[model samples]
Target: MPALGIDIGGSSIKLALIDHHAPITIAASDHYNQPSPDQLTAHLARAATRLPIPPDITAIGICLPGIMAPDGIRIERSVNLPALQGTNLPDLIAHVTTSPAPRRIFTDAHAAAFGYWSEHPLPDRLFALSLGTGVGACVLDNGQQLLVTARSSGHFGQIDVGPCDDPQPIGPDGGHNSLEAYIGLPALHARYGSALAGHLTTLTAADPPLRALVRALRIAHAIYRPQHIALLGGLGLQLAPHRDAIKAAVDEHLTCIADPAWSLHTAESSHHAAIGAARLASA
Candidate 1:
């Protein structure tokens, strides 16, 4: 049987058909950028119709960008794509497909963690951090139990570091301190008073503060105390420029273990949510 994975994000949706028999052969792949909820549904339906082995697909997995409770009904607070709030995504997709294949919806971070764990299956405990417009985290225990949190449990960006007040401002003067304040793309641009893209390029080449920012993330591992940590997403991968610095920082902050091996895995595709969704379906 094959599995269909779909990752829904603020800007794009990614789809893939994976053959369980031959996991290496991704039968079909597609993506749609910035489509409305209804449009996205329609596109997925069309994709389903065109899949090479539609009847063989055992399940469909969807990685959503908001809070999804265990009931699979209520969607809470999708900051990037607000339209998803309160939307029952499983029903919507089922209605669109009109197919009996099972479906599963997972938080984007959880899905990424699943994808990572599927590859590296031995860790007794693992923490996954996704860095992009914001930070998302997921934790796995004994390679089975997924610790889902209502609050920003793995939201690395929400961690407070310095005295710059809150990174995001609410109402008027109420600010909140989060890692996003210093490391987010927008904050970085604002701090430099320049375009984020240009600043990112320059930072990649040589920026002492940026290097320190990378080190700070590694230091976070000490507080969490997971057996291993995996970094995901584009921004997380970019931190590789300062990997040695980060390792040094981690060693300096950590006391429990002499030297911990923190594994870094870049997102295999921009559509990780979609890939994760498909994996969910297969599972």
Candidate 2:
């Protein structure tokens, strides 16, 4: 059986057909921009039309960016995808896929962790931090997720790294001189005042985001003490090119704190999210 795994990102929507015979095998996949609420069902309909194979989609697994209703179907509020504020996810997906297939909705962060777990099971303890249009995280302990709710998890963006009298919020609600204000793309955009691609290519060692990320990493390491910490999401993956610099900076900053000695790996943002969803679809 094959399942449809969808990863709903603030900037992009990634979906794939997961082949059970091959486990994480993606039979077919598609990518698109995050659409508005009214356009979602149609977007799903169109994306569904392009599947490599036809309608035997056993179950649909979706990873959402924000809170879900208590019913677990309606998305209450998405910081990045505010358009999905009150959409009924399961019904919308069911209407388009036209199968009584069970749907599983997970926080994008949890999905990332689950997706990583699906691929790499050797490490039972994992902490996945996702930095994208919004910021949050998820943790796995002995294969069980630490945070599962409609609200939000690992609100890393809200962590206050202050100097400003009024900090802007990274989590979506309040505005504070929070970590998101320093590390988020919107913050970079604000600094440059343009929508240029690769504007962050020339980051410096003393850059605020670099400092903030190192600080966050140290705190997460001390708290979770996971065997591995994988970085996910658009900005997080973008840091791959600068791994050496980031690591060096982290080492320099951790003189007082004991080294946790965990390895850092980049999460296959789209692949892991989809694969994890597919695995959960079968569960």
Candidate 3:
């Protein structure tokens, strides 16, 4: 039997149907430019109703942004998407799908981490940082479990970086000052003004600040001390120019710490959350 996986983001939603452990058969794929909560829920329900597969599929999984409680009752605040706060996602999706089999919901970062581990089969102490519009972090401690916390693991973009206090663009009341303010794409654009696009183009040509950014990420990983750090999302894929600098920085930082044995890798797919959700649903 096949399993259905849905990954819901602030900007887009992706769905896939996977049979056994083979390639995913995309039943329906659509991208919403900027979806409202009701619109997103309706879109997912419409897609789920028209799935071109057996009704008795193995399982169904949905991955969402923001922090989800283990009991699945409440969704904590979402930085990118404010409308999702306090939503009962599990019940909402259940109402939408109405399928008899078990349903699962996971944070997008958690799903991506699980998907990466499912493919790589890494050590117990592995973490994944997804650098997209924002930054998220997910960690697997024993390879069989997903850590749940009031503070979502992969929301590392919220971590305070240093003494660079600028008024937050999102809002003054909204909590903002974090590493994301420095490295997230939108924030980078805001800071660099018109030079942002050119900077990315130049990054492809080896920009110095971009290289320094990679080194900073490596330094953060060294402090975390995970056995492996997997960088995911679109920005991570474009880090090839600074790959050597990143590795060197990681090595240099680790040299001071006794018995440090961590390594870094970039994830191969943007659909990792969907893939992982499908795999978890089947499992």
Candidate 4:
């Protein structure tokens, strides 16, 4: 049976029907700009009514950019979407579905990592960085997520990568010299005004985000020694065309423990989190 996946981000919300059988496939999908909490609740209600399959029979997976309670029922904090803070996302989704369909929640980064890992299983150890409104990271070892509880996979965005005196921007988390401060949407917007999308392709190893990303990838390699490192999310996928350059930059000054065959990759689609959410629920 196909499961439903919902990914709520700082600027958008997406839904997908995922058939994760022998050959995974997305049967259907939808998206909308982020809206008020009440509007989102109404939208889910309408979506439930219009779904091609009954909610009662479908498993639902939801992911959000925030810190969740240990049981995965409530949001402890949401830096991007303050309106969702303290909200019981699972209950809200269930209220709209009004059915017995099992539901699960995940941190957006972890979901994206699992989604990417599902497609590329050869790499026993996979590390993924999600760059969007905020930055998130996750690691999958042999298809099992590590250090994940309460929807936490460790805050990769908060790691200080810049000099203390560097007067660059900071993300919502207010972690000075943090990775997110260097590459998050707000920082990129500050660096490249309205032409951000066009500018992603032109970024080089010496550029702001890429430079910071290389530093972060080096840190990831030293710690995790992942066989594959995936760049994912809204902004991450933009680096797809320049993968070779980014990989070369990371390969420079490489860590001794890093995998010799470690490779860089991008998610096949921006909807990976939503699809991953469904995959998580099914599991």
On TM-score, the candidate that comes out on top is 4
Q: How many pairs collide in each candidate, listed in order?
A: 10, 7, 2, 0
The residue pairs that clash in candidate 1, if any, are 4-278, 5-278, 6-274, 7-273, 7-274, 61-277, 157-179, 166-176, 166-177, 167-176
Cα-based RMSD of the predictions, in order? 4.6, 3.3, 4.2, 2.9
How far does residue 266 in candidate 1 sit from its true spot (Å)? 3.6
Clashing pairs in 2: 67-150, 167-176, 167-177, 168-176, 168-177, 169-175, 169-176
- Cα lDDT tens digits for candidate 4, 1-283: 7787777777666666766453444332234444677766665566555545444447888888777777667788888777677788755676445556788777898888887777678558888999888899998887788885454567898888885225766667877789988888878887899998888878888887888888988998987788988999978778888899989988987977888888888867887887788888888
Q: Encode model 1's per-residue lDDT on 198-259: one tens digit a residue.
A: 55555541353344345545555555567766666556566655555555555654566423
How many collisions between residues are there in candidate 1?
A: 10
lDDT winner between candidates 1 and 4: 4
Residue 7 accuracy (lDDT) in model 2? 74
Q: How close is candidate 3 to the true structure, as a TM-score?
A: 0.76
Sort all candidates by lDDT, best to worst: 4, 2, 3, 1
lDDT of each: 0.58, 0.67, 0.65, 0.77
- TM-scores for every predicted model: 0.73, 0.83, 0.76, 0.87
Q: Which 10 consecutive residues of model 3 have the lowest summed lDDT?
A: 164-173
